[model samples]
Target: MAARREQDFHWAAVDRGELVVQQCRQCAKLRHPPLPRCAACGSLDWHEHPLSGLGRIISWVILTHPGGKDAVRRTGILVELDEGIRVVSNLVDQENAAIGARVRVEFGEPGPQRLALFRTLAETPA
Candidate 1:
């Protein structure tokens, strides 16, 4: 785990095919984009914990001209995890993204690092 920041741990976890978040050991609160200290209680004692990889789409944007072909091929979403952490990542395994959609975290190769992205879970036919 040669990560410079807290989010680096999350990225590292994703690289290992796991979803993790920063949890304050003192306050037992989860934090995203990992901070040096817990925002809830200013606790520097923290640990990385695995998440369920389930979340709902809170916001999203479609990039028509994302500066490159690969960028344009993907869609982005801001997902609110069940633990209350919101992460902005690309949505995979789908053709389009929609609001209020249920999503799960997935690992993908995006540049030199392993990245986490959201993939739409298959919907049960109504």
Candidate 2:
């Protein structure tokens, strides 16, 4: 497969335990899955803006497919970050998750690389 080239700047931040998004220098719009040019202004120049790593679960699903013995079940969630960008990551340290549940980021160094994972915040009794 061909290299993406855009996530280069993004992974650098992830390795450092920080999540960043590309913001167009010309239009000031933040973009995830970083791209080379701005969608709004088509500006090549941009900056890496750090995110708060706080978000809510917009949606989620559990994966139980076959991936050999090494396959551990996981929940993939669409997190709507506080900065307004929606990110796809795994929801960990919990049993079942719900839509609209708040989450906080947790850095995981699974191997040589680091990734941003999330955990559900404790829900208050209503």
Candidate 3:
């Protein structure tokens, strides 16, 4: 499969330091990995809904690229947003990572492209 032009808005928003998901115009259901049509209502009409950039780590995994010139390891996390949307993003600050840790979106240049990575939220002084 190849990248679709419909997804350009997503990367463009990321470039602008904004996180967004596609909201179906018909059913108002939000979905990540922007699709051309809504799976729920089969509606082609949709709009970009800005995310809170807040979520909790529901799951995670450490991925190691073995047997490659650029072999490296990184932690990937599955976060369920406060709005109930689940997104897969990489964790930057892996120090206090836990399954239910609170995290927020942080943009970073992994290579030449800006991407939405995440990090554990700082604990408040009590």
Residue range 74-121, candidate 1, lDDT tens digits: 677898887888888988855657777888887878667778888887
Top candidate by TM-score:
3
Which candidate achieves the best lDDT against the true structure? 3
- What TM-score does candidate 1 reach? 0.82
Off by over 4 Å in 1: 1-4, 64-71, 124-126
Tens digits of per-residue lDDT for model 3 on 18-54?
9998999999999887888899989999999999999
* Model 3 clashes, total count: 0
Name the 10 consecutive residues with the lowest summed lDDT in model 1.
63-72
Taking every candidate in turn, the Cα RMSD to the unseen true structure, in Å, is 3.0, 3.3, 3.5
lDDT of 3: 0.87
- Estimate the TM-score of every prediction: 0.82, 0.86, 0.88
**Pairwise TM-score winner, candidates 1 and 2:** 2
TM-score comparison, 2 vs 3, better candidate: 3
Tens digits of lDDT, candidate 2, 43-84: 999989999998899989886666553356678899999899
lDDT of 1 at 8: 67
